[model samples]
Target: MPAGVRVTLRTDSSSLVCRYQADPAPTLNGPGERARIDVVCDGRRADTVKLETHGGDAGFRCEGLPGRMAAPGH
Candidate 1:
């Protein structure tokens, strides 16, 4: 990791966010290898959130949905 090579992602309200420290010597297309720190946040239906990443390999993807909303009462 290098100084000033950090990635940060936040929501419009700035309530939900993520931060990642960049790795200078990153390995791509390898097993158990990561170039960036991975972070996730869920609004749980109360709000909508977006994700972003930086300072790592050019190829990276984040996928998944937030927790399901609770049924009417329980």
Candidate 2:
């Protein structure tokens, strides 16, 4: 993911899934830095995903999310 990029998803399911391919050698601003994505659901901070590589393509599942529509907040 890039800076200032936001993706909104609307679904009635109680969980959210993600699959991504990493750039194994992504540029970083400092040594030992890692990319991260913040997950916000229903206007609250839910989780943070660290883009750690595990050989090749990887994925994650966020379960038990509220199954409703609501605006996100800062």
Candidate 3:
């Protein structure tokens, strides 16, 4: 797992869904260490995904998000 990561998506839809996997207990560092993934959408933070190394398939839903994906040059 990386220290920090960022992902940006453009959409007009207020409702959004996210599916991800996290390794909260990453063995890459030592025996066991806590790890988590942060989710941010359109400058707005949606949630923080807690993971457990082998943890699989997590879902997140966000509604009423602000902003529309502008088409290049007004």
* Winning candidate number (TM-score): 2
lDDT of 1 by residue, 1-74 (tens): 33345344443343333444446534456565444433334423333232233555234444353434334432
> What does candidate 3 score on TM?
0.45
Give every collision pair in model 2. none
Ranking by TM-score: 2, 3, 1
Q: Which of the two, 2 or 3, has more lDDT?
A: 2
lDDT of 3 by residue, 1-74 (tens): 56656666667766667766643423356755455556556455656655534355555556655557645532
> Model 3: C-alpha RMSD to truth?
5.3
Q: Among these predicted structures, which one has the highest lDDT? A: 2
- Between prediction 2 and prediction 3, the one with superior TM-score is 2
**Which tens-of-lDDT digit does each residue in 6-74 have in candidate 2?**
888877678788877766644467677667777788767787877655666656667777777665452
lDDT of 3 at 74: 23
Model 3 has an lDDT value of 0.57
- Alpha carbon lDDT of each predicted model: 0.40, 0.70, 0.57
Q: List TM-score per model, in order.
A: 0.26, 0.61, 0.45
Off by over 4 Å in 2: 22-25, 54-59, 71-74
Candidate 1 Cα misplacement greater than 4 A, ranges = 3-6, 11-32, 42-57, 67-74
